[model samples]
Target: MPTQGWSELGGRLRAMREAAGVSLNAMAAKTHYSKPYLSQLERGIRAAGSDHVTAYSRALNVAADALSGPSQDPLRVAHEWLVADTPVALHREAGRRVGESLVDELERRVIELRLLDDTIGGGDLIPLVRRELADTAEVVKCGSYTEPVGRRLRIVVGELAQLVGWVASDAGNYLEAERTYLDGVSAAQEAGDSALAGQLLSSLAYQMSDVGNPADAALLAKSAVAGARTASPVVRTLLLERVAWANARSRDREATRRALDAVDDAYEERSPGIAEPHWVYWMSRDEIDVMAGRCLIEMGDPVSAAPLLTAAIDGYDADHAREVALYQTWLAESYARAGELDAARGVIERARSAAADVNSVRLIRRVEAIRRLVS
Candidate 1:
């Protein structure tokens, strides 16, 4: 295998192991390798031979080939397949029309992947989601379809691009994430789904806020809301929340408060009769409260943020390690800011414990920031 291949393979292995909740010591035990040996492999200090790869596969409970195979450059493939071709590729394979069954299967797979993302780090999901994008792109380029079918296929492609962009962002590949999100925006526009295009833009804006581009994030988020005037109440609320976050990150308290108020108004306008997008399925009163609390945290009002965060986190699912750790870290930061050092340290321990089994670089960084604060 190429050196780059081994390095990428090492990252995948480490992700899978951590996602499986296996500690390095435990993995070494299972693989019958020394801790130092496994460490070297995971750090890419030493290339993994086939035997070493097999050991990692067995320890992580993944397919051996998944650990050893050459890594595909999904970003390159995406640009080639999605950007270089016509809106819908003209060249088609004979007798290979896109069908409802294929589309249905693809939709199901997308939902499955989204659900998996809730419980695992992006490192674990990046390769799987990228493969889905690549395969779907192939179908879109080669398979013949009616206009309606083609539109649906393009929507699915756009959804996968959003997911790929999300995982890429979580894995700290910001440039790849931005490029993929733009590709999805194009796909959504081509499908004539303004709501989906808005969603993609909002997702990118959220990422920008996280990566310290709050001005750009705020602009893109507001534009998303303006462009998708017909979006459902929930979708509108989600976009509004991103705007709040961006503004908060920019330290514009007035703008942040206004955006937060807009979120509440949009959410209250939600009607039972209106069909919400599947992507917004996780939105709830508590979710909104959490975002509001997070906004307050960003605006340096931990006193106001603490209670909202506490209540929301109190009812959160503990099994979601990354989310739990992230929320707890924020909560801990609130305590530290409020001069409740003991409380902050206590919460930091809980956050650290929650983060122990996860492999998210973002989560780790956030937790460490809080840890440093408390220490």
Candidate 2:
């Protein structure tokens, strides 16, 4: 049921259609909407999302924002689609053919936003990323795309959701993080991309590990490892590393050792020069070394952790402030254990300073832990 605002917006839409000198049937033909549906939409009996506006604008040779005119109240105009009444029994729209250029543009923007996450931290980029996700989700729902193209679009949406969840976690918004992670998992499954789904699950496992029971965390990691069995060896290796980390946190030394050994085997099995998941593009010897060191530290094996931590810190990019800060904590702890107070203090200071540039609660907590050691 369209309310007063929706009716006003509908009136504007009708005016636009009429000014274009197009019949309802012609508009329906151009926009790929049924004539009856267009009539209902124009008569304020139906509400439309952003994708509908985009399609209609394309048909009328007008801009999308221009189609959503200011005839409605500010709040209604801003979130008109959100106010749409959802049916109790859901029905998914069938996939149709969206333009490749449109998909390509979204893909490019996604990658750029991901890179921004790497340098800027999640706190600053969460709102922008969240808004982008909403916009892209509308495209996935309403744009006409073939089954194959629709699959690709779903993957894009999944990737966006994953990024949003990652950012949310970093910013300490645990609830939002979990919700987006679950949403991404559904999206990945819908796209029939098990590898992506497993990756997202692994991320969720890690997030849960922060505050949940070690057993629960370990189970989540194990599930991810099982689900990604057919994925690339690198992907499997990464997930296995998480398993080791979780087990170590639980103080299951035997389980941690087994997981670590499995990760080693997976790494050795990987073939060189093959393409990897874009999400894991940053994984390398340095990342593995860091995870291994982290697990060792968690298991109270600072003696064994020291060398690995040092190597990882040396090889890590200085520009990655959040990671540098985090890795430095374990490295500092190792030094403190070895009675190298001066060296530990020095590294901890550097880490703390680096962490200041980021807004991650996790890294900030690590920073505080190391500061106590320095004192």
> Which candidate has the highest lDDT of all?
1
Pairs clashing within candidate 1: none
lDDT of 2 by residue, 56-174 (tens): 88898997667776332322322442344211111123244466656765665565556456555667667767877877787777777778878888888888898999899988898
User: Per model, how many backbone clashes are there?
Assistant: 0, 4
TM-score of 1: 0.74
Model 1 CA deviation exceeding 4 Å by range: 1-95
Q: Candidate 2 — which pairs collide?
A: 96-145, 96-146, 97-145, 98-145
Summing lDDT over every window of 10 consecutive residues in candidate 1, give the lowest-scoring window: 85-94
- Cα RMSDs of all predictions? 14.2, 15.7
Per-residue alpha-carbon lDDT of model 1 for 101-203, expressed as tens digits? Answer: 6776677657656655666677767877787887788777767778888898889989999999998887788888899999999989999988999999999
